[model samples]
Target: MPVAVGPYGQAQPSCFDRVKMGFMMGFAVGMAAGAMFGTFSCLRIGMRGRELMGGVGKTMMQSGGTFGTFMAIGMGIRC
Candidate 1:
């Protein structure tokens, strides 16, 4: 997204754009958090090998989706 000169050079982004940006940012953060939490939880539960990978992956996806949805809604509000 490029900014323009003064006086309405660049128009406001659409709702979809805002939501997309928010979702992406949230997903990045969520995945990091999920990875840490999932890794620890699985290890604490004595999970290993494929089971640990699956658990971490599942947790990451769920957290990413949850965060993305909330961030999208929050950004889309635009007020």
Candidate 2:
């Protein structure tokens, strides 16, 4: 097969590499979703600006932990 090269002259990634890349992209997206969920949940419960800001870190940590666990499980099954 002819190897495709980019501007940096790196050869094209293999199928597994592509899959890993996709998984990382998905992981980032999940983290963003988790952050949004945390923010919205705090707001919906009537938290004010300062309270909301204070809770954001904790909420994001919890959300990220949960999401990371799920992702790990999924990747374990697939890989």
- lDDT for each residue of candidate 1 in 4-68, tens digit (9 for 90 to 100): 35576767666788889999999888888899999999999999999999999999988888898
- Runs in model 1 deviating more than 4 A are 1-8
User: Model 2: which residue pairs collide?
Assistant: none
Instruction: Give the lDDT of residue 73 in candidate 1.
Output: 86
lDDT of each: 0.87, 0.70
**Candidate 2: regions farther than 4 A off:** 1-27
Clashes of each: 0, 0
Candidate 2 lDDT over 1-73, as tens digits, reads: 6878889998877666655655565566666776788789888998988898877667766666666666655
* Candidate 1 lDDT trough over 10 residues, lowest sum: 1-10
TM-score of each: 0.83, 0.52
